[model samples]
Target: MSSRQDEVPTLTQPSEATRRPVIYDVTRIVTRALNAAPNGIDRVDFALARHFLARDNSARGALICTAIGPRLADPDLALETIEGVETLWREDGDAEADDVYRRVVEALGSKGFSGASPTRARKTPNLLYLERNWRAMRRWAPHLGRPLRQAPADAIYFNVTQFLVDRSWYMRWLATRPDVKPVFFVHDLLPIEAPEFFRAREALLHPRRVSNICRYGAGAVVGSQALARRLRQYATEKGRPELPICVARLPVSPSFLSPAEPPEAFGGVNYFVVCGTIEPRKNHLTLLNAWRALARDPAPPKLVIVGKRGWLNDAVVEMLERSVVLRPHVIEAGGLSTPGLRRLLAGARALLMPSFAEGFGLPVAEALAAGTPVVASDIEAFREVGGDAIDYIDPLDGLGWLQAVRDYATPNSPRRRAALERNTGTVAGAEEFFAKIDEFIVRL
Candidate 1:
C-alpha cells in the first residue's frame, strides 16, 4: 500500500470562482528538507500542502519566508521545492531495494533485528540545494505567484508549519492586509508547558510563538483534543478570547494502516519496539534500565529503538554507546524508511512507549492502527488518542513497566490477546482528515 503522507502536489487548477484563495506556506518543508528526515509535524505540513494545492481545488499559491520577509513562490518554483523534499525523503522509492531498509525488515521476526549502517553514505541535501533552489525561484518569481497588492480579496493565508512564528515581520503584512485571514497550526505547547524537556531558548521562543498566534491568528489547528484544550486555556490566559479551533487527530500512513502478519505467526523470537527521539522527555533511561535487567534472561526479547538520536541526552547516549549488558538485546535503528518502520512495528509483540510527555503519540497510534498492541505511558494525550486500547502504565513505575513488558514478550500471552481483542484503533483516511480541514476553513 502507498502512503498519502508522502505526496506533495494537490491543487485543482486554482479555483477562479470567487472562493477564498489559500496561500499555502511550504517554507519550513523547503528549508528542513536540506538537513533531516520528516518528523510528525513535517508530515502534517506535507498533508496540508497537498490539501490546499490540489490541481482541481482552488486558484491558490505558495509562500516562502526569506531572511528579509515572507514572499510568494511562483508556480514552477513551488513545484520544484516540493518535489525536492519528496525525493529527499525517499517518498517514491522501493524500501526493500536499499540494503539498510532490507535489514530493518529482516530483523523483525528474527531473535532481534541488528541495525546496519549503509555501505555507501547517503548523499546530503545540503546548502548547495538551497542555493540552487533560491536561484531558480528568482527566475520564476514573475510566473503564477503575484505580489501582495495583487492577491485576491479576503484570501486565507494558511500556514500549517510554524515556520516563521518568532518573526513578526513575515506576518506584519497581515496587519496591513486585513482581507487576508491568517490561520496557523499549533503542533504543541510542549516547550511552554514542559520547559524542562527542551532547551532554554526554546522555552523563551515558544511563548512568542503562542503569543503570535493569539495576537494575529484568525483560527488554529491542533492534533489532539487534549492539546486543543491546553492551547485554548493557554491562549485565554494570554488574553485571547474564544479562538476558533479545529481538532484534527493526525492520520497514519497507509504503510502502517495496512494489515500485516503478526510476529506470533512468524515463528520466531518475539521482539518489541520503542519509537521516538532518544531524549529525556521520551524517558529512554527507564527503558534502558528495564532492558539492562532483561538482558540477564536466557533470551530476553530484543528492544529496537526506532528514531534518530536527539538533543540533551548524554546519559541515554552513554548507555547506548557503552552498555555491555545492553549490547545483545538492544538495537538502535535510527534511520529506517517509512515502510521499514511499518514492517518493524507490524511484527513486534508491542510498541513500547514510555514517554514522560507528548502532544500526540503518533507511534502508539501507528502500532494500534497496524493491529499491533501498545504499551504506553499513562498520560492524558495517550488516553484521548489511544483510548481503552492501550496498556497504560505510569512512566515512572519501573516495576509496572517491567511486568507488562515481560507479559507482552511471552508467546500466546492472554493479556496481549485480550488487549488486541478490545483494541479500537483506526487510522483516519487522508480525505477524512482533509474534509475536516476543509470544513474548518469554511467555518473560518
Candidate 2:
C-alpha cells in the first residue's frame, strides 16, 4: 500500500530568496476527519496547506489550526499532524460498521426500513457520538502550541472551508487585524447563485459570507474566470468596486496521475462513472432516470455512482434503495480510496458528470489526467478545464445523455477514441498552480 504522499503532489522546498511571509489558516484540515472520504473543498484546503509549507522552510511560513478559536503552531508540526490524520483517514473503518448494520437491517426485514419512519421519535445518538469525537480531538489541542498572538505579516491567506466565514469570533478577529491582509480562495458562489439547490439557511448565510469576504479580504482567488467575474460583480454590487480578484485554476491531484490496475469491481464490464456527492445539484436523479430507460435494453452498460449520500436527495435514495430496474445495473460505491477512484476512472468507458452548475469541475480534469473519456455538462467550468477533449451535453437532456452514454459504451466508440487522442500530454500540474499563486502573492 503506497502512502498518500506518493500519490498526491508534495511541496518542494523553494530557494530562501523566493520565500515570503505567509500564514495558512488550516482550520478545516485540522478539525475535519479528512481520512474519511473528503469532498472537493477539503482536498483544496489540504493541498493548499501542503503547498504553502513547501514555499518556505522557516518561520516566515506558518499554519494556524483553529476550531471555533484560532491557534498558532509550527508549520512542520501542522503538516506532520495533517499527514498522520490523513494516513489514519485512508484506513477508514466505516465499511466494517456498515457491514454490521447491513446484517442487522437484513435480519429485521421490512421492520428495519420502517424503524426510520417519521412517525417514530428518533433517538438522537449523534450528540453522544460527537462528544466522543470531540474528546478525542481535544487530546491534540495541547500540540496546537498557542493562540495566534499577532499577525505574522501584512498579508494572510485563508481558503475558507467548513463554513468558517459565518463564525463571528473569527471574522471579528480578522476584522481587527488591520495590519494583515486576507486573501481568500472563493471556490464558488453556488449558494448565492443557485440557492434553490441548497438549504434555505445556507442560502441566507452565503450572502453574508461573500459580503464579509468583500469587506475584509485584501484579494480573492477564484478557480475559474467565470467565478472571478462573478466575484467582481458581487463585490462591485456590495460597494467594493476595486477589490482585487485573480484566476488561479486548480491543478489535478497527483494521485489521479499514477497508473493503477483496473479494479475487479467492473469485472471487465463497460461502466460509466459519476463522481461527487449524490445531491440535488449534481443531477443524480437525471442519470438514474436515464438508466431506468436504458434498463429495458438487452445490452445496456453499467452505471457506477461514486459518492456518499448528501442532503435534499430523498428521491435519489429511494431509487437506489428500492428500484428493481436500477438494482442490477447501478452500483453505489460511496467510499472509494484515492487509489480505488483512480483505478475506477482509468478503467471506465467514460466519466459522466451531469452537474447543473460548477465553480471548477475537478473530476473532469482527473478523468482527463487518467486518460479516460469524459461526458460532462456543457457548463463554462467544464469547458475551461476540458477544452475540446470532452463530450458535452445539456444536463436536462435525458435522451441526449442516454444516447451519449450508449455511444461511448460501445466497444469501439469514436467519441471515446477522440477523448483518448485529445487527452494526451499532461493536464495542468500543481507547479503551475503554485507559480500562479506565488506570482499573485508577490504582486500583493
Candidate 3:
C-alpha cells in the first residue's frame, strides 16, 4: 500500500481517450447548500469536486445543471461554490460550540428541549450567497473563455448525484455533447427493489434513472461490490450488460475520521441514536415500538432519531406527535450537521439502524468510526460495511431489537463490551477510493 501511490494512474491523463480534460457535474451539492438537507450522495459530490479542484491542472470545470440547460462554471466560481457548500454543510469543525450539538445535549437533560427548536427561531439559510453565485454563473455561458460558437469537447462529465438523471434535458446534454463521456455514481437500487417502502413516484422514476445510466453512461461507480453486482444486473436488465463499473467502497469523510469529542455526561442522560430519514424504508416504527415497550422500565435509555423527515411518513409523524408514553424517551434531532452527528454518536449507547433496505448503510460505518457500537439489521450492506464489529439483528424482529437495545444500554453488557473492544477505526480511505476511480478512468 505504501508504494501504490506511485503505481496508481490519475484521472487527468489516465488514458489516451480521456486525456482531454475533466468536467464534474456538481449541481446537487450547490442546491443542497441552501436546503441543509445533505445526505450521502451530496457528500460524494462535494468530495469529488474537492478532489478535482485540488489538482494543479486548470483544465477542469463544473457543469451546473440549470433551468435552461447545463451551464459550465469556470474553475474560480466552481472552487467558490465547492468551498461554500463545505462550510454551509458544516463539514469541518468540532462539535463543542455547534448549535445543534448544544441543542441535542440540552434536550437529553431537560424535558423543555423536546427536539427541534421553535419554528420561529429556526435558522433560515442565507440565500444571498447562492444568489450571488447564481448571478455570476448566469453570465458564464462561454465555457471558460471559449467562444460562444465553441463547446468544451473531449471531456468526461461525472454525474455523481442523480439530480436530473431522468429528465429529458439531462439526456439532451449528452445527446448534444457527443464528445463528452458520461459516468455516474450509483448509490442504490432500493427504490426499485423495495417499492413498498417508498412513494409510488420514486419506484417509477428510478427505472428511468437506471435506464439513463445503462443507455448513455461511459461507466459507473458504486460503493460496495454488492452494489456493483446489482448495478450490473440492472444494466443487463436494461440491455447494457457490458457496462463498465467500479467499486470504491465509500470513503468516510475526514470530519468523521477525526477523534470525536468525549461524550458529555449530562446528569446521567444516556441514550442511543438512529441516523436516517424518518421514512418507512428506514423502519423507524420498529425502533419506536421497541422504545414504547421500554417505557415500562423504571429508567429506560433514550433514543435520538437524527435525520430530517422524508416522504410517506404519516404514521411515523402521527406516532411522534401523539405518543405521550414515548415522549420522555425519544428525541427527533433532524437536519443535524456532521459535527453535531459526531458528538451525538460519540455519546450514544449504540447507533440503531433497523432499516429494511439500504444501498450502503453509511450511518453504521459512521457510528463505528465514532467508536460507537451499532445494532443494525442483518442486511447485506450493513454486513459489508460493519463486518462483525457491530451487532446485527433482523429488522422485522421487534422483540429482538428491544432486547438488544436493552442489553446495549447496560453498563457492562457483553454485546456492547465486545463491539467496543473490536472497534479499530475506519478502513475506508479517500486515496484508495479515488485510486479505484482513476483505474476505472483508464479502462474507460
TM-score of each: 0.87, 0.83, 0.88
Residues 1-444, candidate 3, lDDT per residue (tens digit)?
Answer: 122321334456544423446677766655654655468877777788877655545446677755556776555667776676566555675665456666667667775334432311122354764565465445444334332114456667778878789887667767777877788889999888889888999999998898999999988888887887788888888898778787788887766777765455466566898989889989999998998899898788888888888898999888888777777778777657788788777678899999998999888878887788889999999989998887889999999999998999887788899988887776788888876786675556
lDDT of 3: 0.75
1 or 3, which is superior by lDDT? 3
Superposed on all Cα atoms, model 2 deviates from the true structure by an RMSD in Å of: 7.8
lDDT of 1 by residue, 42-143 (tens): 778876787676643356777776644677665345666667666556655655543445554445444532334211112234465456655554544444
Question: Against the correct fold, how does model 3 do in TM-score?
Answer: 0.88
- TM-score-based ranking, best first? 3, 1, 2
- The list of candidate 3 runs beyond 4 A from truth reads 1-20, 56-58, 111-153, 263-265
- For model 1 the local lDDT of residue 102 reads 57
Sort by lDDT, best first: what order? Answer: 3, 1, 2
Off by over 4 Å in 1: 1-18, 56-58, 105-146, 262-267
Prediction 1 global C-alpha lDDT:
0.73
Global fold similarity of model 2 (TM-score) = 0.83
Clashing pairs in 2: 35-89
Q: Which parts of model 2 have CA positions greater than 4 angstroms off?
A: 1-18, 54-68, 91-136, 141-147, 160-162, 264-267
